[model samples]
Target: MDTRTRFAVSAALTLGLLAGCGDDAAPAGSAAGDPAPQATGEPWYDEVTPASASGTTGGAGSPCPVPVSFPLADGWTAKAIEPPKGELAELLGEALTKRGGTTARCEVDGRPAGGGFLRVWAADTPTVAPRAALEGFAAGSGETVSGQQFRDLRAGSFDVTEMTWLATNPLAEEEAARNWALAVQSAGQTLVFAVNEGLITERTDVLPAYRLAVRGLAAPG
Candidate 1:
């Protein structure tokens, strides 16, 4: 099988294992305000291994640093890329296409998430507004979504917003829900994007590393 297929299979298996563990809700004290105590040593997750060219390129400008962090899971990987453009749905569609994935725009809680390209476009390009998007996305998923915003993190030549998403996985009920975070910044006409997932079921514990990775991004002029 191809590398992408392998990655997808691994992700599916991991999700399955997490789903099988009943009461996947993160242990108590994992809320946005109650972040886990900082560890003095190395991050919990391992560094990302490099991958071969995937026909993807960085967005037009450099990525600004955002203050976020998360533990990198074993055997998992992460990569930085340019944020999607065009209408929100179009952009999402394009990105997913690169991964052989498909996406649709639908509503979340009477608000739009699936096809709300305009909302995203008007807000700001390459900005990290996961809360806004998740509010709608979660409502659509029928899962309660909650998170906090880390504001004013400056990296490179852009300002960034770092937000975390906490929700129960509707499809993988036992997978401790899914905790994901993203760092977004705008540069020139391009948006810088980075994402980290499967680190911890709790948003607070995983955000620091997510923030760190965002801050570390350097986009070329």
Candidate 2:
């Protein structure tokens, strides 16, 4: 039980509640000057989100300060997240905020695109490789993770390790769900960008925007 992401298993129950949120219809309001959609043939899903770059985050003026900067899709928003404070909060924070050897730094809400989130998690270890960070992230899942497929993906000029896997939840109507994550490096930290398929959202709903951001990842140039 300690090996799984307890929170993820419980989240699957709400998947149906977010049904239809992943429609292939492209979101409007993308800035005309922003980068265009960069699609990948991998992780093949029926409808790719035609999300355009609304803006970017993680650089100086961005809402959330992270090790890396990535594009934000239209209809999505970004915000910084923090763990709870106080003595009792410290214990809860460990469970709520920290996972897979990383702490959540930025959360890109894709409710307009897919009811889920593209969360960025960062670790203190600057030298940690991408694969190891993703492994920790999967290990942190409360549900049973399997069918993991790992590969090399390019994010801007950087090389990243990407992983796609299936998570099982006994409580959900759809017992098996898909999830994706990628790890990249910055100055003194290892950052993991991931989207979990649960908690009122499905993979299809959020992946378009996720892919857009992943393809747009950069070293805050």
Candidate 3:
């Protein structure tokens, strides 16, 4: 199978597990361990951190437009993308294609982890999401749902439902979770979409920041 196919399968499996937790109230993965350190004010992932010695760049911001109407924890920065086509998914696909990756839209789960369909881009060559790309990461990445709420948002002429997930990062669990959120909007035949890595992790310290970011999202008219 191709890399995209593999990602699809992995994403599906991961989402499936997340979907099974309905009203459990205990939060997924809490049993794995105690929460990590709580970030003060805004976490580093909310802002751009310079690259570390391991060569991993820290705190990359999304390429979406600035002053985008989304909730943010104190100190977190949010950017918005003004797509040329006015459709987020299409714009994301075009951006990925420009960077040598192939893109497609697929049905996503919309329950515990904020299930719904979303567009995913895959690349055999190096590519990055608009946010990561602007930050100079050379890796193939895509955005998907990962949290418990489906938020309605408006961007440009699109109406979108956004979801978040606590992404797992073996090395920087807190930082990873603080940076991921999946936002999707339907614009005619296309879905305007955005995903952040800071909000997609299982760290406790990051959950508050993730919640703050979710609260910051504004419905686009």
TM-score of each: 0.36, 0.74, 0.27
Best candidate, lDDT: 2
Q: Which number leads on TM-score?
A: 2
lDDT scores in order: 0.30, 0.66, 0.30
Error of 2 at 52 (Å): 1.3
> Candidate 2: misplaced stretches above 4 Å?
1-50, 112-114, 170-174
Model 3 lDDT at residue 120: 27
List candidate 3 segments past 4 Å from native: 1-63, 66-68, 79-181, 186-202
* lDDT digits (tens) for residues 124-216 of candidate 1: 332435344433333333445444323234443444433334444444434333343333334432222323233222333333334333444
| Tens-digit per-residue lDDT, 124-218, candidate 2 | 56578888888888877666777776656556756777777777765545566678897888776788988866556766668778878887777
Candidate 1 regions with alpha-carbon error over 4 angstroms:
1-144, 147-150, 188-196, 199-212
Cα error, residue 31 of model 3, in Å, equals 24
